[model samples]
Target: MSMIKAHHLAVSYGHGEAALKVVKDVSFEVQKGETFGLVGESGCGKSTILGALAGRNKQWTGTLEIDGEEIGQKRTRSQLAKQQLVFQDPFGSIHPRHTIGRTLLEPLEIHGKDRRQERIEKVLTDVGLPLNFRYRYPHQLSGGQRQRVAIARALILEPKILLLDEPTSALDVSIQAEILNLLKDLREREQLTYILVSHDLAVVAHLCDRVAIMQSGGFVEVATRQQLLENTVEHPYTRILMDGSRGYVSERRKSDSAALPA
Candidate 1:
């Protein structure tokens, strides 16, 4: 089953003569329970597509279907709840004043879900957070803990699809792996589909079954994980990304080794 489908999708900012198109005529489908990744340099319309899909950016024209239902500029509450977005910066995304429990409760209250307390506790556990942390403010938690709370917030809605936008970019390298592994486990446990946007090829390769490489507001290539791992990707841009990602990993490893006590 196809969880998401888009054809000839174009997204723009502003109106009339001043309208700037950011995503141009791109098309793709993500299968149920599969992770689809979008990769490119900054400002390449990767997140623009995600915004369109999530109904945050309404200036888009295309055939878009989510979980078998067509989507439009305006979405009903249920339509809006079909998928949830997890942002890049956990600290920035969450409320500083709100307790973790309250932050999680807001959505459940809005959606009028039953057993709100039970749901909150379950989601906290699912994300591997202690129940007691619910009383803590966002500031009390570390970066990785804050991100797990963000994941818990998204999952509390019980949405089938997760739209992850640079989910680990703000965390330390060691913490990034922990969050990625949590996402992997959650996907299996929940049978969820994901659309992840990141500039890191290694991150994408680790989590995505297939990836779309974007440049200048359009898709340059869509390659499988096998193709990526085997060095069989055809696009020059894709190869460049692979090389850059390899260099980045090597540099990080060297830096880590140097930090170790001799």
Candidate 2:
């Protein structure tokens, strides 16, 4: 079943006549429990699409359906909780002044959910954080740890869909893999759906079952992971992205090889 369906989606900043469109006539479907990726260079409107899905941008116009129900700007609290967004920058997403426990409790409190302590502990464990870390503030945690808290906060509401906007782009290269692995495990355990946006083809290839290549505010091509791995993409833009990712991997491998002991 399609967990998310979007058609003719458009987003613009500013009013008419002065409006600058960022996403133009975009469309796609993400099946339940599937991770769909939007990949492109910066400013390609991938994040804008995520924002629209999360109801962050009311200026958007399109048909957006989540779990078969059409979504609008004025979403009910329950409807809003059905889809959660984990932002790219963990530092920016979390409240520096609030302890991790307080941060996680906010969502539950807003929804009037009981057993806050139990929920907080479970989400922390689910994100691989020690239960005591709940007393720490965002600034006290490492970048990776903060991101884990961010993921935990997003999951505390038990949202079925996650809109990941460049979720790992700001973390250390070594830490990125760990975060990705955690997300993969959590998705399987929770039966969650994902719409992940990123400029890194390698990240998308690792996490997404299918990917859409975006350029100039629209999707240039959409292909399954097998097609991407097999180099079966036909679009020039997608070809360029694939070639660039390959080049980066080759260079990084050579660098690692050169650094090895003789």
Candidate 3:
């Protein structure tokens, strides 16, 4: 069974004539424990789709099912706890005044979960951060370290699915690999499903099992990772993306010494 299913999903901002539709009739399914990717340029509605799925955007229409239960309807706290979103900008996502420990504890407190200290420390360790680091504020950490904490904040709830909106895009290229490896390890260790949004084909290729290419708020093509690797995509937009990825790879080889994790 699909872990996530969206049928003819549409999302927009505002209402009536003032409304600006961002996602148009997009549909897809992601299997349990699989990493499905949405790849596109900025403003193509990739993050908008993720926001709708994560329940951050309520101005959406159509059927969205998570584990066979329809979303957009009122969900129980337990149902809401089954999914979590990890935002792109870690510094922006976390509160500046709050300590890392407080940030991790907030979710548990909201859910009324017990053993908050134990859960916080375990999540910090699971994300490869020292337990002592939790006592520090966001400003005390590096960009990569901040991103790790952001990820830990999401994982603290022990959600079965993660909506990743360009999770590594805000970090340095070198640090991106480390975080990607960390996510891969966490997903395997926790058996979590993911819907990863990224413009970087390399990042998607490195982490996703299947990919959907979005263009102008709609999906242009969907293909397996092997199909993407073999350059067998049928859509023109997908081909353009493939060409751009090749160019990026060529440029990176000359200038970037940091390789994506294997």
Best by lDDT: 1
Write the number of the candidate with greater lDDT, choosing between 1 and 3: 1
Number of clashing residue pairs, candidate 3: 0
Residue-level lDDT of model 1, residues 31-129, one tens digit each, is: 999999999999999999999998999999989999999998999989988999999999898899999999999999999999999999999999999
Stronger candidate by lDDT (1 vs 2): 1
When sorted by TM-score, best at the front, the candidate numbers are 1, 2, 3
Better of 2 and 3 by TM-score: 2
- Model 2 bad stretches (over 4 Å): 248-262
Across 15-88, the per-residue lDDT of candidate 3 in tens digits comes to: 89999999999989999999999999899999999988888888999999998888765667877788999989
Model 1 quality (TM-score): 0.94
Query: What lDDT is reached at residue 83 by model 3?
Result: 90
What stretches of model 1 exceed 4 Å from their correct place? Answer: 248-262
Steric clash count of candidate 1: 0
**Candidate 2: tens digits of C-alpha lDDT, residues 1-90:** 999999999998899799999999998999999999999998999988898899898888889999899988789999999999999998
For residue 176, what is the lDDT in candidate 1?
100
Quote the lDDT for 190 in model 1: 99
Lowest-lDDT window of 10 residues in candidate 3? 253-262
